[model samples]
Target: MKINIFKNIFENRFSFYRQQGRRQRSRHSQKKERKIGKLKDEIIGLRRRYEKVKKLKRQLQHANLDSPEVKTQRIFQGHKDSSHVRKALQCHFAVLGAVKHKYRGLKNTKSKQSLAQLVSDKLIKKYKCKTYCKKLIGCVSRRKIKRKLA
Candidate 1:
C-alpha cells in the first residue's frame, strides 16, 4: 500500500512538470509569430516604396532626353563664358605688348610667323586661353607695332 502511494505522488509531479513545459513552449511560439508578422508588414511597405521610386526614375529618364534645357546645355558645353573670354584676351594683349617691347626690330614675314607660333603655343598651354591657337596665330601675325627707332 505505501509503495502504491509513492508511485501516485511521483506520477502527479511528473505530469505537473510536463504541463508547465508545454505552456512555456506555447507562449514562446506566440511571441515569435508576432515578431514575424511585424517583419512581413515592414517588408510590404518597403516594396511599395521601392516600386514608386522606380516608376519616378523611369519617367524622369524618358522626359530628360526631350527637354529643351538639355539641348541648350549640349549646345553651350565647351564655349567659355563672356567674362572668361575677356580675361583671356586681356592676358594675351599683355603678353603681346611684352613681346613687342623685346623684339622692336622684328619685321620679316618668317620671323613674325615664328613669333606668332611661339606666342600662340605659350598662350594656349600656359595661360589657359580658350581661343583657338590658329586664330591667335593669325591675330599675332597681323599685329603692327610702331617702333620709335624704325
Candidate 2:
C-alpha cells in the first residue's frame, strides 16, 4: 500500500512540473515578442528623425546658404546630408569596387582583420594615401562584414 502511494505521489509531481514548464516557455516567448516590438518602434523613430534631417538639409541648400545655383545643383547630385546613407549611395560604385578588391585578396589571409590591415597597408604603400582614414575605413568595413555574418 505504501509503495503504491509513493508511486502515485511521484506521478502527480511529474505532471505538475510538465505543466509548469509549458507555462514558463509561453511567458518567455511573450517577453521576447514584447522586446522585439519595442525595438521595431525605436528603429522607426530613428528613421523618421533621419528623414526630417535630410529634408532640413535640402531646404537649407535651396535657401541659398552658399552659391544658389551651385548649392541647389550639388545638393541633388549626392551632397545633401553627409550622412552614412548618403555616402553609401553616392559611393556605391566605389565601395563595390573596394569590396571586390578586398575579396580577391582575402583568400590567402588567415583572418579578416589581418586581411583588412593588409589592404590598408598595401593602399598606403602604393598610393601614399592618408593612413588614418584608410585604416579607419578598413576597420569599419571589417566590422560591418563580421556583424553581417553574425
Candidate 3:
C-alpha cells in the first residue's frame, strides 16, 4: 500500500511537469507565429513598392516624348517655382471666394458659366495676369459648389 501511494505521487508530479512543458511550447509557438506574420506583412509592403517602381519604369520606357501628355507633364514639372505656385493659388482662392459670394444659391449651368467668365474677366482686368483661364475658372467654381452641396 505504501509503494502504491509513492507511485501515485511520482505519476502526479510527472504529469504536472509534462503539462508545464506543453504550455511553454504553445507560448513559444504563438510568439513565432506573431513574428512570421509581421515578416509577411513587411514582405508584402516591399513587393507592392517594387511593383510600383517596375510599372513606373515600364511606363517611362514606353512613353512617347512627342505626345501632348508628355509635353504637359514636362511643362508642369518645369513650372515648379514656389512663388509662382503660391501666387496662382492665391488668385484661385480669391476668384473662388468672389464667385461663391456673387452667385450665392445659383445652381444653373448657364449661371455658373456666366459667373466663371465674369470672374475670369475681372481677374484679368484687375491683376493684368492671363493665368486665370475662363474654362479653368468654370471647372474650379463648379467643383467647389459641388463639394459644398455634398
lDDT leader: 3
Question: For all the candidates, what are their Cα RMSDs to the real structure?
Answer: 16.0, 22.5, 13.8
For candidate 3, the per-residue lDDT at 15 reads 100
Q: Give the worst 10-residue stretch by lDDT in candidate 3.
A: 66-75
The TM-score values for the models, in the order shown, are: 0.40, 0.40, 0.44
Clashing pairs in 1: none
The best candidate by TM-score is 3
lDDT of each residue in 72-128, candidate 2, tens digit only: 346567445645544333343333444566668776755656545544543334333
Off by over 4 Å in 2: 65-150
Cα lDDT for residue 32, candidate 2:
100
In candidate 2 the C-alpha lDDT for residue 58 amounts to 92
- Superposition error at 140 for model 1 (Å): 62
**Which portions of model 1 show Cα errors greater than 4 Å?**
64-150
Candidate 1, residues 1-150, lDDT tens digits: the string is 999999999999999999999999999999999999999999999999999999999987787552333444454578865765555455555456446644664565566556555555443455455254445545633334334335
Model 3 score (lDDT): 0.67
Candidate 1 vs 3: which has more lDDT: 3
lDDT of each structure? 0.63, 0.61, 0.67
